[model samples]
Target: MITRHFIDVPRTDGSARRVHYRRCGQGQPLLMIHQSPRSSAEYAAVMQAWGAHFTCIAPDTPGFGQSEPLAGTPDINDFADALIDLMDALGLERCPAYGFHSGGIILVTALKRHPQRFTGMAVGGYAIWTPAEMAIFGESYLPPFQPSAYGEHLTWLWNRMLEQSWFFPWFDVRGEARLPGAHADVARVDQAVREMLESGDAYRAGYGAVLRAPRDIPAADAVVPPVLISAYFGDPLQAHIDRLGPLPAGWQAQKVDTPADHHQASLDWLLALPPVPAAGLVETPHEGFAHVVSAGFDGLVHWRGAVGETATVPAPGGAISLITGAGIDPPGHGLSDDWPAAAPTDRTVWDAVFAEVQRLRGFAGFDFEPITAGDPHHLYPDLTPDRFGSHLTRAWSVVRAGAFFRPRHQPSAANAIAFDSTAIAPDRLAAKHLALLQARSARAYHAAYGRTDGP
Candidate 1:
């Protein structure tokens, strides 16, 4: 069942702020924080699915939805405090949460100061900014709210909204903008606008709060909790994605095609992750990529491809590998090699994996320096051929089983035993191996190097 209601939550600054909340299902609590220019209403569909497994609670922060704005309107830190207050008001000791854009920044604040208050977090489109990137975002972040009496504000708002819809890297307006045809679902767009209009001051407060808020989330990576990042196309949060770089320890970022898809993807991710154990040894990878299934690891799921390509799957148990395009020389002459040191510093496991496959296919290697970036576990299937085969299979087993191995010391369980093929004993091992290889073979290929076109 789903229920929506309004409750007053106290702010850190001694004011009562109104909070609009939607509750559904009954289980471990899951809180969702909405992005700016959006309210909790955006999560309606998502809460329904997530409610099946969790007691979903989505709240409009102080300045959004039915919520009253903070009196003095403090920064994001103050907003974070209000969210925490909402949790306390509801008698929640701890909760898991999902946030996007500005909301992600707010949660990062909560995680940093009140780590124990959260069970886990799923952050979508976290904006980590480079100096130049921040400069660009600063320009786009807040276009004059109520444009000076001239219709200039309205024009900018209309074009900005429409143009932002296009894929990012908005370079030239060489082409005209594209909006859904008349036959398209006008209702959704109307609904979005209606919410914006009805909110009145809520809109101003929220947008203004966002504008005045600090451009960066302090100690973002240091916030300790199982974090999953879902970044989609046209996501204004790309700056956050870029700033994350290889991602900090215990954090993972996945790239998706759009924001709407993140709810389900994030839910699946949260459900798949096991919570942290209180005592028993907790294993974490020191180096290299390993498929992880825990709240602590980031889910690097990505959605990328041209139309009409094969659908990709998440690597089983969250394992990843080095996959590269074909035509690269094998581990010598600047080509991919078997050992790590043999590979160039620029090359990543993805390139190394790609090089390995190409070597198997008898392709000539090229002098390509690898650009290794830790893709969220979710992106593994799209980028790696074997997804969860032997190469990744060995790595995943170790991480899950929590057994430390020689040559590398970390708490990783061994799934290699389960993955091994005996050809044929009492167990149709050869058949199992054949099936595994076949699935992987479908993904192993050499395509245009460096560009994320598709399979």
Candidate 2:
């Protein structure tokens, strides 16, 4: 089974940053890096496949996923260093690594800086962009992605991710820029959109760093670990192999016919390398999250504050506040796990779940209270995604209404509550909007909990 974890890596500034990762399978450790604007979630299926031979460890590179972003505008070198920091935190001295697209670029840069840190690398696509292509990409590629007051950004986000499969530069609509594998797959596009939303504007920092990164393949004479770089037929980076000029000894680049073939080739190459032992692997504890496996549920549950304190589950549209640190997102809400396939309908299921959480967190007793409002059917809107992305605006409307009224569905002046101007600010609403999007099971959780009366 695949599991998620968080580890705090000490930085040069005498502080620590949390890095979120996914781990599965067992054997020698294999570091997996994902492409930009996406998280380690991208490697879920592949990790399961590769788990039999190696302990697949994939981290969401800094600033892209739940991982904390580096200070200031960082360059590619910074990202490479961050990967090494993660390695050190995990006590991984050296291991075979895998990457795809932007992931491959970061791995290549890391190998160049610290050659002895990796035994071998199986890279899916290593981009070597020319000056002309870089010019076009730099000009119109990554625009500022701040959330707008009315959620206009969501419309652009949905289309941008959707059309990327249709065009090489995504924004370029010319016939020459069209991809042969152009597709309108909604599921694929929706996942990408969610990831980008998680990263928010931070996507520019991580993705821009790669776009601006120089073609840094080590020289033919430079000593380095063996690396195999391959790209599939429909991938735009397949043509970049020609631009790689000359790779160091023991390095090779080739084109493959399909994604399956590329994955198989990568697995074969990594399997041939000497295995790195798992003796040094360390289990690091994350500060604010706990792994809970209670009756009818199993996954990470994010919590804050000392055990035995006031434990409260936030309402349908609520999240654990940074100020009070009192609320916990129930299973299937916020950063907690999604509801199980056969999730229990009984409201008492939550009482047992919280009890398990208290046990896991070392709370003495069940001195807890759940905070809720409105009817379950009315409090949680059906923000299910549509092809046109109307869900984005719908979510924004609900979140915005929540600021001025109790049981946000009732927007009458009689239901209005007093609040500061900052309550309805765009940035604040954007945060709530994101929480709603992230809460995959908010509606179901509410349905199970039923409703309560409020002012």
Candidate 3:
């Protein structure tokens, strides 16, 4: 069952704010932070899935929900500190986390200053606002604290918020033009608007809190944890999407076209990942493409660009010249210029890879992994392919009939002991693979089976 309680979290401002928080389920703790202009209430659906795997703890940031506001000034940094205080109070020394929008900003701040306190983080719609973006937001988001008239205030907030989100130029203009290349479910939009209206001044205060916030939230590269950035269509954060490209190596960017898609994707990601260990680097466009080709392995070769039949293959340690999609090598074609086709040719090549994986792994051919639930190769993306390849190549050394390769648990005892071969099954293999992927626990196996680790 979901459990909630009220507790006072002391701010650095020498005052305490009453925070409404909910904690549920068990296992490693997970702290969830809500975006500005919204309270922790937004994460109700997410908590259900996450709670199963984590002790999901969500708190209403001060000035939103039923929490008390700061008497003077507070910014994202302050919010981070408050979260730390909450963690200490709850006796959670370290916890993995997820956040949305402004909540993501706070998480970033916390990551930079107190990196050790968190296990890892997954965030949705981070806006690394530029100076110009800040100026635009200040005007619309940071409206006056005290409005002259209640009706005028409500109308003004509604128009500003809606226009900023749905129209082009966002804070710069007012129009009915749908944002360029942006789309959303009409019913969802209606529901969000209805909720926003119902929340009243608390929403306004949180909106202003983010609007007036300091734009330069420093990147905590030192705090290397596996971070996933998820974005939806019509999200204003898309404008600053490129800024997220150069984050900590362990960080990953996932773009979902709709809110519902983003929600589901995030839930799946959180459930799959564990506390990060080594600070791995994210793959840049060139590095990513190079790895895709050089490895000769296949799953997904994802790249981000708009409107281009032409693509450039990265040269050895350098940027290669631009060439047609058919011209470059992402495993699919040659430079015989073809006319514009209805669908992308790359999709066909990807389909071929899927088919190959299916044939070998004996699973369904699907775009994303987990081709079918309970499939042995369902954990394809999460499994470090290089390690799996090494194991497969050296199968004789690691395995014998009635005994499977198990990472040595400790160095002091029998290095490799025989286990019942009948117990070795596909589901057991999948579970073992997942346990190894958890960054923190991966090293725990090195003492046993000292096979080379891979990304």
Candidate 4:
């Protein structure tokens, strides 16, 4: 089974840094580096496939996911050193490394400086940028992705990732370098958007470093570990193979027709080699903390939830999603990081959040009601009494503990309650959701019609 974890690495500045990683299988230790603005979550499927043959460790590169970002605007070498630090912390002396896109840049640079640390390497889409290309990317690619009042940045991010294949660099206007792989799958785009939100503007730090870093392809007779570079036809970097002149004696480059073929080829190449038996990194259970742009809020949410999707509790009448001022489907309650520090206290803000959620889920007909999150235990960073003390808080606690004091009468199974992963833990904190929703729904019903009778 694939397990998720975090390890505390000692930083050069004498500060402890947390690096999050996903691990599975029990063969050789193979370090997997994912592209920037993405986390170890990207390699879950890859780990599942490759785990039987090798111990896969995919980290959420610095500044992305739950892993801590660098102290400042670090360059490629800093990023590479951070990775090497991760290796050292894990006690991996020498092992093959695999990287993708931006990850390829870090691995290549790391291998160059410390060739003795790796046995073999497989890279997908190693970028060899021209000055003009770099200039273009530097100007438009890694823009600061901060949250806006109306969630405008989200619109840009979704389009940016979706249109990346439509136009090679995504921001290009002339339709040059158009890719055949452009897609519009909401779920696919949603995942990347959530990761980017976790990264916030820090993506500029990690991703920009790779794009601006110098590239040095090893010479034909250069003494280094075996390396294989491959890119699928649809990947823009496939064209860069020609840019690499005079590969080293142990280097091999190939252009595959598809990503699956590319992945399979890389796997075959690695499996043919002898195993790398290295001790696994010390593991710590994930604390279920991550960030996402959800409900018009850009900030920390707890207990592992994805953006733009809630559990699809199918009710023939459709779902009625419960959102609150605070609590895990949290909006107010002091947990959400809002730049303007807006609260959903106003009906207008709740309406705007509902609209944004609709856009994210990419569907309509679902209903929404804003409830008061009176339960203090449901909040994180712990809401202070001075800030949130009120009748609602005290009253909600009574409603939660008292089973008979349900707010809404028993709605038919035809009506399933839904809440964003942040507002409520999908499974662990589900009971709180039930009590909170029942009370709030019943209260709304009681207010509307002086009666709490069952349907």
Candidate 5:
């Protein structure tokens, strides 16, 4: 089973930075790094595939996922050091690592700086961008991506990611820049766009560092771990193997026919290497969240304050706490997991579920106040994606309305909420926007709650 975790790593400035990661399988430890604008979620399938031979550990790079962003503008070396920091925090003295695309760049940089920290590396693609190519990318590749008042950014985001699969550099549209496997897959594009939305403006930092990084490999004489660099036939970086002037004695680079072939080759190479014992792999305790698995439910429940202490669930457009002695996001809400199938329409089921959650958390009881929406249908808009991405605007409208009215769907004087400029600020609205996106089953959960009032 795959499990999520958080670890607090102390910084030089006496601050603690929390990192979120996914861990699965059990064997020798294998550290996996994902590409830019993506979280460790990208490696889910790969982790499952390699789980039999290695305990796969994949983490979101700083600023890109639930992981906190680095202070100020950080370069590629800072990213490399950040990876080392995570490894140190996890008590991993050394481990075999794997990376792809920009992930490979960070791993390569880490190997150069701290060769002893890794036994070996299997990099899917090592980019060696030419000066002319960098010049073109520098001008138009990465623009500042910030949320707009009306969600105009979503349109551009969808197109940018969609076309990325169509062209190298993504911004280049000429005949020569077109990729052989250009596609218009909506599901694929939607996933990529959602990841970008999750990263927000932080994408510029992580991706920019990759573009500005030095492309040279370590010197032939330098002592380092064995590295295997490979790219598939259709990959744009496949041509870069020629650009790699010379590799260290034990390093090798090659091209494969397909992604499957590349994965098999990487797996074969890593399996041949001497295995490192994964002893003393430590995981920090859950600080700000709790995991609950009860009858008909299994998911994470985020909470604040000490167990058994006064907990508060803040209500929308109201300052009062609805439930006391633990603020928990119910299944299918906030960061909690979605219901596996259709949500149970029975109130007794929900009551038993919450009871189990309370018991697991060691809470004696919870004080509940009835929370209702006047028009439940309109309260949660249909966020289904359309060709033009109009759902984004609809979601933004609901989020903005939430700040001004008691029942976000109704905006009369009776429902008027106190005007607070801070609440409507773009950053605040953007946060709520992200929360809405992440709450995949909010509509179903709300409907289930409403079904308790059967005719």
Candidate 6:
């Protein structure tokens, strides 16, 4: 089965980048890089197809999916560095790779900078734009992706994704550049839209870097790893093949008729090469982190500092390992990646998180009672409808803000000291929690559906 995982990798600057990836099959590693505005989720279908032959590791490139983006306006090479950092952290000395579009750009950059790190590469549609074309796209292809309080951006986003297939430069409709493949598929559009939502403004940062990046086509004299560049007929950049005048010794370019043909060609090329064993996942000894196969969520669930090592929470038949804290990316905290758009409720999320904890740690049940700042109970009441607002408020807040960065439902005990808990007496904590929750609800309302009135 295809499995999801997260590994904390420190960049060259010493900041940690929690890289999230999907892995399956077993053999030599084949690192898969995805195009921007999408996650490694793009390779879900392809991973299964190629998993039997190779241990396919596809990561949500920084700032796109679960993995965090680079700090500030980073260069495209920074992304290449992130890839190297991930490889080093995962213990992958050298591996073959396949990249598509912007993914191809990233891998090519990495290959140029460090040729010994990769055995070979098979890339689909590497963009080779002229100076003027680069300028046009760099300025307008991707805009600032921040969320508007009224969600006015949604209108543009939906249309932009849908119309992208119809037009080369989506903004241009000058008749000559209209694409024959331009058509709408709800499922396809929805998938991209949800990813874009998870990405938010970070899309511009990642994608913009690609547009601004300089290409380094290997010289014929330079000894480099083999590379295959394939562009399907319908691909927008198919013509760029001619633009690539000369290639290195082992480099070859092909113009394929269809995506399936292109994919098969790439697959065959990879299988033809020698396999290099990838770094396997390390086992957690006692109290640490592990990627558990949860029904809905797939990422790391940490069991450090939750409870004692030998201690088990009382349960029905046996006992459950105490596991707490959400994952560390968008939506929640600990180490999970992006939250889905359909979006589950607080109860469902906790239940799913804990269930994975129980199953992975070989426990029958769990006794997880988190008393933290953003605990769902603060927004949602179990029995009596408490003064705190409904869970919908927080969910909507997260949806609108494009993230739940600072969940304002309930403050920790330290905050009580911060807000003068003793002076306000008995009702102080309760009042403060309710006030914060309601205030957050109003902001969510404004951001989600443009409701400006305070709760």
lDDT of 3 by residue, 33-86 (tens): 988666676777778866777777887787765456655566656667878887
- Extract clashing residue pairs from model 4: 325-332, 328-422, 328-423, 329-423, 329-424, 330-423, 407-439, 407-442, 408-442
lDDT at position 5, candidate 3: 54
RMSD of 4: 15.0
Q: Tally clashes: model 6.
A: 9
Instruction: State TM-scores per candidate.
Output: 0.51, 0.94, 0.52, 0.66, 0.90, 0.70
Model 3, runs deviating above 4 Å? 11-15, 145-150, 157-165, 168-177, 180-223, 272-455
Tens digit of per-residue lDDT, candidate 2, span 110-197? 9989889999999998888878999998899999898887778888999999999999899999999999898877777878888898
lDDT per prediction? Answer: 0.49, 0.82, 0.50, 0.63, 0.77, 0.65
Winner on TM-score between 2 and 6 is 2
Highest lDDT: which candidate?
Answer: 2
Model 5 clash pairs are 311-325, 311-326
C-alpha RMSD by candidate, in order? 24.4, 2.3, 24.8, 15.0, 3.5, 10.4
> Which consecutive 10 residues in model 5 have the weakest lDDT in total?
314-323
Better candidate by lDDT, 1 or 6: 6
lDDT of 2 at 82: 93
Using lDDT as the measure, name the better of candidate 2 and candidate 5.
Answer: 2
lDDT of 1: 0.49
Residue 299's lDDT within candidate 2 is 79
In model 3, what lDDT does residue 295 have?
Answer: 22
| Residue 235 in model 3: lDDT | 77
Q: Ten-residue segment with the worst summed lDDT in candidate 4?
A: 311-320
Please give the TM-score that candidate 1 achieves against the real structure: 0.51
